[model samples]
Every structure is written in C-alpha cells, then in structure tokens.
Target: MSFLKKIQQPKFLPNFLKVAIPFFVLVTIFSLAINSWSDIFAGDFAKVAEANFNNGKWKAFFGYKIVFSAIYGLYITNKNMK
Candidate 1:
C-alpha cells in the first residue's frame, strides 16, 4: 500500500526523538496509571491516591503532569503558532 511508503521517508529518522518522545510519554503515563490501579487488589486505590494528593504525602501530583505537559507543549507545539 502507498501508506507503507511513509515509513521509508528519510526525514525524522536518525534523530527520531521527534516521533519517539511523545509515544514514550504516553506509554509511561499509561503504565503509571495501571500500577496506580494496582491498589485495587487491596480494594483501596481510592484511599491511596487521595492520601498521596490530599495529605501531601507526595507532592507534585498534578504539578508533575502540568510541568511535563508544558515542556512537551513548548517543544512539540507547531512553530507556526508563534
């Protein structure tokens, strides 16, 4: 199929972070979510995430995501937007 031709394109390769970075971020988030859900085995995931965030046991809950998204946005945002 013609679609396969896109794979052979020589543009982003070699320096492939242009494609790999976003994918790695998404997969890492997904894995963290799955592990966070592991507390469901004890039937108490809700309590854990709440304790971590609400009690400030571990800071940067939303902060990490916010900062990462911002940095990723800065790097990934279309330059044409500026």
Candidate 2:
C-alpha cells in the first residue's frame, strides 16, 4: 500500500525512533512516579505492587504507553517529513 511504502522510506524509521524512544522512557518514568507517589510517601512499597497487580493496572498502563508512544511517534514523523 502507498501508506506502507511511504513509512518504509529510509528516513522514517530513524526519525520515528528518535522521538519515540525517549518519549516512551520519559512517559514510563513519569507515570510510575505519579502512580507511586502516595505509596512512596506513606512508605508502603508492597501496596504499590499489590494495587497494580490486583487492579490490573499494569495492563492498562502498558496499553496506554504503547498507544500513546505510537501516536506521538507517527505525528512527529509526519510533521518532520512535511
């Protein structure tokens, strides 16, 4: 498809990776900090893991991170190409 071919161009991958990797890492760390802030302050590390596992928050976090990173990467790549 034209869309696939366009994305497969030599410049696309590097540009996408340049923005996406750091964005993904920063987002992951920021989300963890925010999510664990209360637990950290209260000195309850066990509760953080318990809540994440029991509420299936890990799955939701992974899904959000992937979706957001992909969307942001594509947006930046498109902008740069244009």
What would you estimate as the lDDT of candidate 1?
0.52
- Tell me how far the alpha carbon of residue 73 in candidate 2 is from the true structure, in angstroms, after superposition: 0.6
- Candidate 1 residues 16-68, lDDT tens each? 44544665577556645665666655878677577555677445565565566
What are the Cα lDDT values of the candidates?
0.52, 0.82
Name the lDDT of candidate 2. Answer: 0.82
Compared with the true structure, model 1 gives a TM-score of 0.43
In model 1, the clashing pairs are none
Ten-residue stretch with the least lDDT total in model 2: 1-10
Q: Which tens-of-lDDT digit does each residue in 21-78 have in candidate 2? A: 8899999878877888899789897987776645777888778898899899988787
- Highest TM-score among the candidates is held by which one? 2
Candidate 2: which stretches are off by over 4 Å? 1-5, 41-44, 53-55
